[model samples]
Target chain A: MMQIVKPDFEFKKVYETLYPVIFRVAYRVTGDRALAEDLSHEAFIKYYERRNPLPDLKQTKYWLIRVVKNIALNYEKKKLREKKAYDKLQFKYPHFTQSGEAEFIKEETKSFVQKALNKLPYNLRIVLVLKEYAGLNYKEIGSILGIREGNVKIRVFRARERLGKIIDSDAI
Target chain B: MCPDNETLSAYFDNEIPSPWNKRIADHIAECASCQKRLRQFETIKNYLHEDREPSFESSLEQLEIRLAGLKPRTERVSLWKRRVAVPLPAAVIAAICIMILGISLIFSLTRSNLRTMSIRRGPSGTTEVQVAAPIEDLELLLKSLDTYYLKQEIIITLPEDSLFNITGEAMMFREAEFSRKRE
Candidate 1:
């Protein structure tokens, strides 16, 4: 007989084991802990809604990471559009002031490394995040991002180089 | 020629294959510039790793509570996979076929049993009647005719196998007669 529903205990165990990795990947990719939490919740909700559970925890982790990656990409695009619009508005009205809370959050939440990570191009930043935070190998990262392993390696290197430049300039 | 930083970085990550890996190692060991570049990659890796992952204990708790409230959707089984099951389309077609067969059967039986009655005057000036139908249908037809028509001496011809008896002014169908015929 086919299994209809996965038991709740089994699901809970998987959730506890994978939550940290999922949240870390989301945080590193988006550079916002709160957004990361939201993304993590979204990913788990998707997992719970699936009719059939993946065979094992490793596959489940990969599946959740892929969901978070796609969600974060959409968010990144939206953020970019908003930033472009904001920049346009700022150019139009030179006297408009940014919200004090926004400035405060930026100063308080962003570490030097995260600020540098944010400066790298989106493609390079994602590859580097998977490498350093998720601890995935090049082939795995390539599989997750739909790029070749060699491309993943080159992106990781380029991201590191750019990040180093940004950090060094900031330090100076 | 010295390998590029990308190659060195791949080498640092142990991503290069056998002979190239050894070759890059040999080059880095002898070359000061390559060594400095390798160190830069190491420094960058350290810097990325140094940023600690923030604790998400409360978030995890909240997520767990949310998940606890959710029930996983039951897997949908295809009709083909279900045992002793007919697909919805096939069952609908079968029902329509049965209904059509039943309706056509009823129509054909009704047509075969229909009777037309004809009344005419004979050369001798007396009325003559003719009807060809099943006995049960003839009895009903006669009962519905006007009493003026029934007053005349009428004749009804039934099938040889039909069992019918007419006795009184009112032509009534007896259930016992039909039941005996059926038996």
Candidate 2:
């Protein structure tokens, strides 16, 4: 008899295995702990509901990271659509600014950083997030993103250059 | 002379080739602007490394409970299909077949002589006995048997010498019982 394995068995095991990595990835992208937790939960639920096959832990982590990135991007787009000022950098660095003008300047600086991070296309964002957020090395990121290590290095370099320009412009 | 961005990035990443690595170090030492840029990259690295880990502790219990509550649909279906439905099905089928066959044989013997015959003239005006056994629609017959009384016999009676297709005979009795059960 050909037996059909219940998808939930695989789902539970996969969630247990990849949850931490997914949570961390979401946190890095969204820059909010609670939202990251929720996003990771939602991602797992969505993956489970799709009857996704249980991949090896590494692949699952990569998939989870990708899902979190797409979701966070959509969220940012939605904020932009809503025309909320804080939406530009909704998760700002909590370090306080003393003067009102200084606070506005800091806010603008953060906004510039957010906009730059958002502008770097999915290709660069994936590499940058893998390197800076998930802390994956070039080889690991190359495998996850299906690119050469050299390509990964170049992409990260370009991303950092763009980010530096954005921050430097705001400082001026 | 200062190194380019790519070389500087590689130098910062600690992946530069030996001679180029030494060259970038020499440039950083000689050039204040390049040194400041190197410090900036170092700051970026520190900020990245200083990222706080997110906590999922509050949601863990709920997530676990939900996951636990999610009984795989195949498992439930399989449990019923295998544990309950499989073991005694053959026996049930056997019992049903036997009961149907016995009742059909008894009924057939009682009504065997009541079959009607008909004759029709063709173009040649020939006469023939068209002996036709009236075949009851089993489904319809079973549907109408609600009015009839059933003895509910413990032991089924069978003829001493029976020769016929047992399947058809069993079907007849099964139909009759099904009809009676509707009442």
- Give candidate 1 regions above 4 Å deviation: A1-7, B77-183
Q: In candidate 2, what are the lDDT values of residues B1-183, reduced to their tens digit? A: 777776687678876878879878987888998888788887666645554453666666567766556645332233345543455889889899999888987886775532333433333445443434332344452233333413321222222343333444554456457667866
Candidate 1 chain A: worst 10 consecutive residues by lDDT? A1-10
- Model 2: DockQ score: 0.17
* Candidate 1 chain B least-lDDT 10 residues: B163-172
lDDT of 1 by residue, B2-35 (tens): 9977777888888899989998888888999998
Highest DockQ against the true fold, candidate: 1
- List candidate 2 stretches off by more than 4 Å: A1-13, A50-52, A84-126, A139-155, A158-172, B14-36, B69-183
Q: Judged by TM-score, which candidate is best?
A: 1
Best by lDDT: 1
Model 1 lDDT tens row, A35-137: 9999999999998888777889989998999999999999999999988988898899977766958967765778888878888888999988888888788
What local lDDT does model 2 show for residue A107? 41
